[model samples]
Target: MTDVPSSDIAFTPRVKALQAQRGSRSAYARMEERGGFRTAVTPELAAFLAEVDTAFLATANAKGQPYAQHRGGPAGFIRVVDEHTLGFADFSGNRQYVTTGNLQENERAFLFLIDYAHRRRVKLWGRARVVQDPDLVARLMPEGYEARPEQAILFTVEAWDINCPQHIPRKVDAAAAAAALARLEAERDRLAEENAALRARLGER
Candidate 1:
């Protein structure tokens, strides 16, 4: 067997110079000098987020490694309990418990809600905590629905920012929101037909 040659890779002179220009110390100093940063969510953003049924929940571990999961519920699932408070249900999942585990380590989290049909997006940053009180869950549960076995996670909003839809591409068919469900039905039909054909061939054998 031939031996592979070893190679050394290093930053170019220009890259090294650029890196030195903004070291971690300088970056941290600049951030510290900013005092506090806050952005209010516009009325339009609040309305859009209220209308959407899904959002992407992003959380990070103590080391700042981020994980994102898609969360969905009925329309108006996300509730703006107050001007600075937002809450949503935490349904069951694969049980990886990444978000819940991360929140235990680091309460800071972020959420992004996008209405593809409406061409809008909202970003929310806040501190989150996993709440596990039966009475509280009972109060929050929708009428006629049982409480999920998994506990819910609540997020207390610290700041939120609204992005304009000017940059979002226009949607061609807003009514096609049910296309995915239709595709699933079609796939089920196709599988059934294939199964029936296989059964017929087996009988012929």
Candidate 2:
């Protein structure tokens, strides 16, 4: 994009050095100039996040013991609060509270979101906070999900990166399969009605 390295929203010292050594620094720098990676989310990014039903959250305690946890819900469980903020309701589960504990010890976290059917993924670096506000919990709730909300986990995004679909295997969403079935049934019904109408006209003839 630009002639020189423009920004490093998610790049650390180790990352930049490695990219330089591998001769990819310039390419990455150009990408940055094009806003391929950014510290703030865009409206398009918000909509993408809202439609995903699952994400993996990575966190670490103050001791640096890392933990990876899966968060899921009906589609649209995650809400984009602002360009820089997104969050979801913490549902009642095993009560292990590993994530909650780690967030208390260290707010730093990362979210990995994937869309298997589209073979797309996005990673976000952020700080998470546990919220107890009732209004917020209610606001983030999905329309017909039965999960009990414990607390709201709010992520304040620092930087985000999107990945190419190179190695991601294409898969299908269950809902997509169901939608296909419905379409097939509707087509079949329309054909059957047309056939019946033709038969009646031929009988009259």
Candidate 3:
């Protein structure tokens, strides 16, 4: 959680204006017609999506200020439905809902998927819509799992691109995944204990 100064990291007006002008054209020719940028997703992109368990989602506000949030789930959280479509399960968070709020104002978003275990990364760009259809959510959920009614957001991906792995280092560990899960459970238990103590002290007042 490092705070990035709004001034230092802000997008230039030219870039912001270009994004606004691009709007929502899908085809490269149509995007070119509107002076928008375009990129193609490759097989490498699909492989990275399958391996990565977390991603950083970036969006902007009405004033063109950008925000980035790290989102995580079990491996395969982001599913590639096809060459152009991607799906993911969005769960409850700190409740600020900044990403959702930004999407409402501007559907444009960028997703960064990094597979640290393999030191690989990919970038996905698209428009997202929050969906609440039970059937759709159910279909997206892994086998033997049910969607939590209150904590799901469906992202309809429009375009994506894969980056070259030249900068990424190679590394892998079989135990790393299990160790991470155990650490999370331990932290949750510690937090619950502290919360109970705080509640007990309040009752004594």
Q: Tens-digit lDDT track for model 2 on 1-205?
A: 4343224546767998999999998887667678655777798788788679899999999999999999999877889888898989999999999999999999999999998888989989889999999999999878789989999999999878788999999888888899999999999999999999999999999
Question: All candidates' TM-scores?
Answer: 0.60, 0.87, 0.58
Error of 1 at 9 (Å): 35
Name the candidate that leads on lDDT.
2
* Residue-level lDDT for 187 in candidate 2: 100
Q: Which residue pairs clash in candidate 2? A: none
lDDT of 1 by residue, 1-205 (tens): 1121110011234644665686734543343255322334457656776678778999999999999989876656776656666766676778899999999999988888887677877777778888887665555454554436367667776656556788788664434647877888999999999999999999999
Instruction: Report how far residue 93 has shifted in candidate 3, in Å.
Output: 1.8
* lDDT to native, each model: 0.69, 0.87, 0.66
lDDT of 3 by residue, 1-205 (tens): 1232122122245654665679522343343454332244457666666667678988998889899999766677777766566776666657798988898898888788877666677666676767776676666665543434334454555544445678777765557877988999999999999999999999999
Candidate 3, overall lDDT? 0.66
Clashing pairs in 3: none
Judge candidate 3 at residue 67 and give its lDDT. Answer: 98
